[model samples]
Target chain A: MSCDHLDLALASGLDLLGPDEAREFALHLPGCPACRAEVETSRLLLDALAFSAAAPAPRPALRRAILRRAQASRWRLPGPVAAVLLVALFCAALWLGATRFPVLPAVTRTASGYIIASLDPTARSPHAKGEVMLLPEAGHILVMADGLAPLRAGRVYEAWLLTRGGAHALGPLHLDGWGYAWLHARVPPGAFRGLLVSVEPARPGPGPSGSTVLATSGDAK
Target chain B: MQEADLPRRLARGDARALAELYDRFAPGVFSLALRRLEDAGAAEEVVQDVFFKIWHGRALFDATRGDLPAWIFAIARNTVYDQLRRRLRQSRLSEAQAAMLDLFATSGFEALEHLMAQEHIAELLAALTPEQRDLVRLVCVDGRTVAEAASLLSTPLGTAKSRLRAALARLRQTLATEVRAQ
Candidate 1:
């Protein structure tokens, strides 16, 4: 069924429609499949034409950075479900052990020195919540998270230690079956400002290159 | 490492498969990004994002939908749109320019048509008459409005519209056929 708005739809896809025509087409679009398909096909064709642009090789540093991150994540957790389960159990045991050993002076002294920061969800994942236990004296930062959406393929949950200097990657957070994950990383030396959990590529760039899923209000001094 | 096995190997978290994929598609990805973004650094970042997503999302690749290159370019297209959106958001543009961007903001749809079109962009352009191709280049690649393109080409507004409409219709029909054949 050819609509009178067909020309307007095609022009709209090419971004050639004037404001008045664009608004008119927008109103007509939801009701017209033929015009909608025309716009969709036009956009796809233009997207494909974009590929014909001059191809330049990426810098070597990018390749190295991506591979390095991927390799690090691969080695950090080698196996499948069994390995993840083992790591989860080990983390639980460590959390349990740390809490149970109250008499040890380092644990005791660090316990008082630790700053408990709430990892509040950002707009990206509103229902998600987490907490970060930053024990600077003990040289440890423990992250416990719940209600994280399962990551899309080619993505992972990464923790970052945000300082005035910059955001330093803590590591990838591997959640178990129940949508919960705990990450225990040695607190790197910095005047820590906050903690962030972002959905990053499995091979993320040098900084946090994804949406901030959970973060603390930058007061973790 | 056969091309056919790349998806499976990548899905299994094989770093080598990722390297291979990057080697194969990074240049095209970088080119597409650089063309859209016009900033080398941003383009490089897009390349990184594209490959990273490919590696992590390997499990999500459905061979039934299209081949690896198709999937890679689809991701690249979306990533470039993201970079463009980010740039627009960060830059202090005039209201008119911003409104113009708003018009083009709905340019994120991807399909098998793009994959088919990507492989045959030159051929597809060749299929159009010289005048139609020039009109397409002016309006599509150069990002000019149809009226502006008509003025530049010294063609009548009605003639330019008909030529462009016909040219686009041909390309769409050809690509749709290619998609169905696949």
Candidate 2:
């Protein structure tokens, strides 16, 4: 499998290969140990370049600026549409009040430490993605999501805390019509291996009774 | 979190995951920018821009495309280059001045490699003539083809290639020695 194609090897490593040459190299690479070694060396050399540089600390205020911008950009609706939506929301709140459905709590400050888990790709919605941030210090966990679809009539999206002990249901999420939700819940102190979000029938149970729609790490924490 | 899981956590929009990633790589990003732009304030701006774009586009990153570190450095390089271009446009320099400035813009790559090296490698690199150093920077660090580097240096391609190959061989020998020492 060895070849004297040093030029091709170096060019491939540097991303200087033309499309056809790149394709040809891709085919050649699988069987060529020497070329693979050249590419590896190139990578190592580039890494050494990074490692040898003098990294100065970033300005402290930059962090706040980034966070502020991110927060401002999330879930923004247009101005006039927002006003009409507000009126509609007021009417819906009154109707919900008469129906006796509980109100959802807002997300607050972050705790000192948290464990994060990414939702499983298979269980997630087509365009939806989510993460579970376990805030053990504040005794609450935050489930942040984007592109989550609304459940069918009488169906709800529920969160579950999966630990070595057992699966603890945290109740259904209250998503806005746009399919974004930031659900926060109070919990007793505990470690978790994973978190699961699922679509369940009306009046969800003490355990998951339907297919999972999103999930964190599959293994125990 | 494991290094392997950082990308997943980022894709899920976890702030803590971002904080961890920032803390680990920000220094390198900041330093690369600082070396390129030679201004702390500008470098900080590059860091912010790079990380913000990374967060917003986290899901788009394909692991198969390249490792996170390489992708990140590419961003840093491009951002700094854009900034340099902007400065050049703003200055309204003559063609000759602009070309000289461009050389300075490109020269940062080698200086960065030198700055990033440890004592032994740094010592070995220091032994190289300034032209040899620039050749290494242009070809290896900046990812330029040998022919392109020769054209930039206004040297014959054969001479540039031979010189660069020799410099790289020395660097490789030193690095191997360092590994043995470790």
Candidate 3:
């Protein structure tokens, strides 16, 4: 096929091509630098997306919430509705003289994927230290850290996904009562080269306006 | 744990095995849903549902046929499509909205294509003009033939073809520049 036809064919999406034509294109593709590059572009797009999809991890509470609801019953209900049901069930059990409620197991979310980078505290943010785990296939990044001080009333710690495109604020890192925080971002693996943590104003700006207190030591794997 | 062995353990009714699987796949599954749905609560719901199906419906997956990630991602795609449909049905959707619904639905390919195509490409794709984006939604996202997208958009087939080429080219250009910038 001509290059024009090949471009149209690729743009038409794979479903358009007949099996024979697709097979023929596959045979022809290896020798054609241009077509090969186009195909690679498609793959790279998917990779970038996969990274973005995994950028935000679900709230940790979601796990306990999901497991609790799943254990409570097989019925699928929204989180608030499920909470109401559980409360009602508890009240009824109390009225009926049953004293025990189901015990919730300790829930921990471990990164089942590879380590993208291990971050250390910068001189400006000497208390910060953590590692970023990448679930590439899953399209998620988990950043957990300790020794972070609670921000002032109007301040927040924002995590940035430093990519060639630019620094994207992953979201505000919410620290729990104990000064420990885990930020979940839905970023595709290797889409960004590094991670940066900055203490910003209460509201975020286009980019970091505060000091880079913590960051990845090297290129993100 | 080995990914291959996890499913086998799950099939044997190990709760720990299921947890291990969840630890491994939840973020990926959740990310896919979040990118598509753009709602954490809904995305979380999707992740919970995907894992539930995997553990309870283990028999439906035959390992001899394919590996676990492919099977899990197939379920993820179908679940995301279901969520999209539910959202679409809840509102009086516009043509653009309906086009988005059609775009994300995975009908043609088996697992791998669904997984790859379902990744969050909206950012890179945002480089295209609105017109080009619509064409791409129809052709790539919706898995429509270029001719079909052309007909749906009421544009000539050649125009649709050129628009798609331009859009893909733009995506490549942006990606290349970004990589160099990094």
Candidate 4:
């Protein structure tokens, strides 16, 4: 019929409707197949983009650059905010760093020789975690210490190679205040099984004695 | 690590990589801002702001927590919204910018109508004169409600609604014809 009146019929909006006009429109939609299709088309498009607005992608370079800028400008953030952000970052980094991939201190193994880095009683880890070492000298093994905190006076440490049979004493490891440590010892042919560090009483003895401080397996490098 | 890797590379001062990312997304960002701000210069500025955010504001982007694209978009969106609010607050539009804004108003609707290939939408848009085409684009593609379009066009709501209804009628008629032909 006369769609000149159709303007009045449609302005109520394709998506929205009032009670009486909506009822009339509903009746007309099923009967008037064309209007039904038209409504369906509009509805489809609207449905296609209902919740989210269609966004064109940003340039990758621009995106990366802007993100970089945003991150940098974060430094320009006000003091309290910056502090809070940093603290949060520091905590996150520390947690991730600690749990995920803690650094493994580098070790140099000598060819044709066995090595070990024994621990002394007062010697402690400079870092929260540390690595003891084994080096080979000819047919013997030289042990080393790395990342251990310096020792306090009136104390010493001992080292032992624990095996399937029992523990063997590698003897006295020494260190001055920090960084890397080198200990000299003979790698008994079978003592190559496992090695450990223990905080021993201040006297040097011919045995793996005193309390076991921090014992670790002495294995092939 | 993959997520942090780029920003970390960027953190140490890599500019070329950032440019690569820029070329990738500029079109979408430009089109988005153009639709919202309706000014080429403002849109360009919006794009620049988006670039600055990704390049210099790497800290704001938590790749571990979110996708880079999403972060970039959020920032771009905020920049556009902020500019919109500022434009609204300004009591007077300098004659030059006002002139540019009016450019989008002229024949703008026809351009949008021409883009409307769907039989139903084409029918709806055919009833509108080129002048009313601008109103339809503002409502549809650019996402303005009729009330918003009326304010934008500086016309009465009744006038805009009337044009909308007429346009919608045309769409139905066009759709009806297309349906019969099919």
Q: Which prediction has the highest lDDT against the true structure?
A: 1
lDDT of 1: 0.64
Q: Rate the local accuracy (lDDT) of all candidates.
A: 0.64, 0.56, 0.56, 0.46
Off by over 4 Å in 4: A1-221, B1-5, B92-182
Best by DockQ: 1
Query: What tens-digit string does per-residue lDDT give for candidate 4 at B10-107?
Result: 54446655655565456546765765566767887678755654554443344443445544444454455445434533634544334223222221
User: If you score just chain A, what TM-score does every candidate get?
Assistant: 0.49, 0.48, 0.48, 0.36
User: Per-residue lDDT of A133-162 in model 1, one digit per residue for the tens?
Assistant: 544544455676767999779898998866
- What DockQ does every candidate get? 0.21, 0.12, 0.08, 0.08
Model 4 lDDT on a 0 to 1 scale? 0.46
TM-score of each model, paired residue for residue:
0.52, 0.39, 0.38, 0.29
Query: What is candidate 3's lDDT per residue for A1-221, written digit by digit as tens?
Result: 23744553344233334567666765675466556545534543432244334344567787665555434423233346545643553343233332221111111111122223445577787756555544444335556555777777888888886665667776676464444555554554345456788889878898899987778763211
lDDT of 2 by residue, A1-221 (tens): 45766456544534456689778877776576666665544444544554345444577677666665555543343445544643553343233222211111211111113344445434347445565554443344556565677777998888776655556666677564434554555445444445788888768786788888777643211
Which residue pairs in model 1 clash with each other? A153-B56, A153-B57, A154-B56, A154-B57
Lowest-scoring 10 consecutive residues by lDDT in candidate 3 chain B?
Answer: B105-114
Over the stretch B60-142, how does candidate 3's per-residue lDDT look in tens digits?
A: 45565445665666556556655555456456454433544543331212312323332325666677899888876665454
Alpha-carbon runs more than 4 Å astray in model 3? A1-54, A68-221, B92-97, B104-107, B111-182
What number of clashing residue pairs does each candidate have, in the order they appear?
Answer: 4, 4, 17, 69
Q: Pairing residues by index, what is the TM-score of model 4?
A: 0.29
Residue-level lDDT tens digits of model 2 in B1-182: 69888888776666667777677677767765665465788788777767755665454455654456655554455455545544564574444334333433322222222223234335766767788888766665454577899899999977886677666656655655655574
Higher-scoring candidate on lDDT, 2 or 4: 2
